[model samples]
Target: MPKPPRTRAAALTATALLLSALLAGCGDDGSGDEDLTAQELSWKDCPAPSQAQGGGGSPSPLPDDGTWQCATMKAPRDWDDPKGDTIGIELIRVKSSGDESRRIGSLIFNFGGPGGSGVTTLPAFGDGYEKLRTRYDLVSFDPRGVGRSEPVLCANDQRLDAYFQQDSTPDDGAERTELVDSTKEFNAACEKNSEEMLPHVSTTDAARDMDLMRQVLGDDKLHYFGISYGTELGGVYAHLFPGNVGRAVFDAVVDPTQNAEQGALGQARGFQRALDNFAADCTSKVEDCPIGDTAQDVKDRIAKLLKDLDSKPIEGIFPRQLTQSAATNGIAQALYSKEFWPYLTQGLEEAYDGTGRTLMLLSDSMNGRSENGEYSNIAAANISINCADDKPRYTPEYVERKLPEFRSASNVFGDFLAWSMLSCTDWAVAGAADHPDVGAAGSAPILVVGNTGDPATPYEGARRMVQALGKGVGVELTYRGQGHGAYDSKNKCVQDAVNGYLLDGKVPTAGTVCS
Candidate 1:
């Protein structure tokens, strides 16, 4: 199965390097000549999954499971002209199962991956939050160029598989040539197949779509819950439609203040912190401790292992060997959620046993690759959205110059995170929006959640997000724990406070902590 739908968006920061490129698009002010209409969502029974006949994987009738009703609402392909071509906004809804009189309203969700399917993510939340279901209708949609929507398909499975295994940390001129060639090849595939859609699949466009969804759902104001990259979407929506914002929750907040480079570097440091947390926890235990007694010792062992993989890839069940990129991806993916720590330990143990099959599977799952070689549009769409949102150019010279700083930020994962920005460096089209200040100054009280040990979004971003949202309008809720997000984690205090705010508009005081 794919990694939990709460998968993170790529970390592309606005760097000083981008100072030279002129930012093209501006935020949508929701003021236009054409009027928007609320089309009724024609709901229907969701389709069941088509079972696999052979070893091939089962085809999912996603955005819909039998428990919910599904609809495809029409949205403008280009929001600039409301009269322009239309695209389907795939949606799914689960009505309140509680007292009808107590219904709060429809709660819209965006579960982070600029590519993550709300259709897939909402079910996970729905299964856990019974109270949320009773009080409000839960709704989620596949954003433009994502999932069931007009997805951005760049390379096919074979090409992407090769791209994933290519060495990211180039030690020599030949290695750098391979890395650059693979990146350019992937970009060419995207340009070939999705050039038209690639230019428009940005956070600004997605935020406008959210307003249209609000109108169709008959909600006077948006009741939103955005996690991880979803927080960026939520912040964007608030910026564009502050008047329509109501009871919005941004968990695992992205730092709007940071540019693409800062964002990337922040994430690198965040992952390193999470790795340290994992090390600290593992070493404290008598069993399943793959590293040493001290955190630095654990780091040393991991560094040695990654170095070994660089020269000699361990054989795995997958078509490709366990390359360093895949190994790092697997380790980073496991760090997103604490529940996967044991699997990380297991994978590392098996790697020490000379086979990297387990870690390869973890990496594959995180990348949305099925066992039968069927790949989802998550990776493709993620690249397109991020590139469209923040297209910062990077050269071999720039990467080389900044490599030391990146390594300083994160001795283990820094190089990979910094190089992650390379795919967009030569984007076919410029980024749609510069991601202007999203303070959303006049929006209704917005609750921002942050985890102290979050490996992806980082706590500092959440703190900064609150500051950007302005005083009184934004409230900060801190989860003093290790994870990418705070809500739905083990902390009941954070859960109760968020649930109360979403359901009853009760904002927790600033600096609220859930230990």
Candidate 2:
């Protein structure tokens, strides 16, 4: 048992503090969507069990029935409204089993979209999560106005298709205006059609709903897990219910205090770092690599392809041709996983021949566009919640100024990647009052996971978050992996570490590192 390197251990400890905090909203981003400061309604007992018809105020028992139930619980239309209007919550409850029978409580999982769906997760990606299912009920649902729960739909299919298919990067004034107009149009339509629900979709409000769910499920406290955007949602819950927090794990954490504008800029810088990693990894394989001898070469090749797509979108992909939108999306997608950079090389290779199916597939995944011409509207939700979640430091001209640096950093994906900031420029709601500092609260030890090379969420953000939260003394779990969420892995080490904590309330020792 040799001592860990002093400087290395110091850095590790600092990293831990930052990330544990990042996953929570310590800073003020007043977007009611993320107001961690607001005090929460106290946790109460669950409603009478599904089996209990009526009782003399006896708390209900858990539904032992094997089948998981998809049901709606009710919350307030507005947190401000103590009793005015009620909103129904859609939930999926997977019951626990066997020795794990006497489970602590329901484990609420949110899959990160301010627009993401929880219903579709387990059957698809929870392959690594079945064990947790055996101990506690694994449940998730479309958060208010998201997915199957009376979702927010803006346009009819065709126009919606156009919306998803629209170019993210605007080259000329007309293009930028179109992007702006399109965004405005979507916002207007969403407001006009989904007006009643827009304000209610804020994260704090949803955290409140989660407490209600905890009550209905009879959990005295919460045992929760959130990913990506889910981390924000989880932080909101923790902030609103610091007393009720228990064994919470925030994987692929999001920095709460940084408003949407900051988030986008950080994400842009992040993707560039991820791309650089991918390029280096790709070229190391030489023949298998798609980019050239250097990471810069790959970036240059990508830029040339995007510029070409902007002028002449390559046809032959699917319902729509390979537009700059597709190319931008494709490049961004590859930034998430080093595994995909090979495809990045192939995409570049094909586009260099004046075609781009390889790249379009990458774009399709990045945008969450399905084969049926359907999309998750994640990009839309990304804009909606992000813009609403926080106020941007509006220096409109700063966008133009940052162009060179962003491009040099990201090449093909810079503007489309960079312009994600623009969504906040015209935000309807300002951010939280102050991005509160997390980890200041002396609650249970929080677990912060960071992939050394995640593109969208980025490792630096995680480092900053853990550092902020840990203040140099917290549990920092390193996942030497790539992509947005690493827990999706079937890998034994990650599984063991996470499962041990959730099931046994164990927190890995400080400076614990995993590959």
User: Against the true structure, whose lDDT is highest?
Assistant: 1
Candidate 2: deviation at residue 397, Å?
A: 3.4
Local accuracy of candidate 1 as per-residue lDDT tens digits, 1-515: 11122344221110111111212011122333454564677787644311110012222332323267778777777877777667777787888877779988899988787687666556545665566777888898888888667778888778878877889888889998888878888888889997768877889999999998988888899999898889999998998999999898998888888767777788889889999998889988877466566877888888888999999999865468998888888888778878678777777888877888767877766676656666767787778888788756677778788889989988888888777767676779787544546778789999999999898888998888888887777898889988778876748999899998988778898888899
The C-alpha TM-scores of every prediction are: 0.90, 0.81
lDDT values for all models? 0.75, 0.59
Model 2's C-alpha root-mean-square deviation from the true structure amounts to 10.9
Looking at model 1, the pairs that clash are: 13-259, 13-260, 13-261, 14-259, 14-260, 14-261
Candidate 1: residue 447 lDDT (0-100):
92
Per-residue lDDT of model 2, residues 302-382, tens digit only:
767678777788763655788877667666665554545556676778777877776666665544454445555444444
Query: Which residue runs of candidate 1 sit more than 4 Å off their true CA positions?
Result: 1-36, 48-66, 433-436
Candidate achieving the largest TM-score: 1
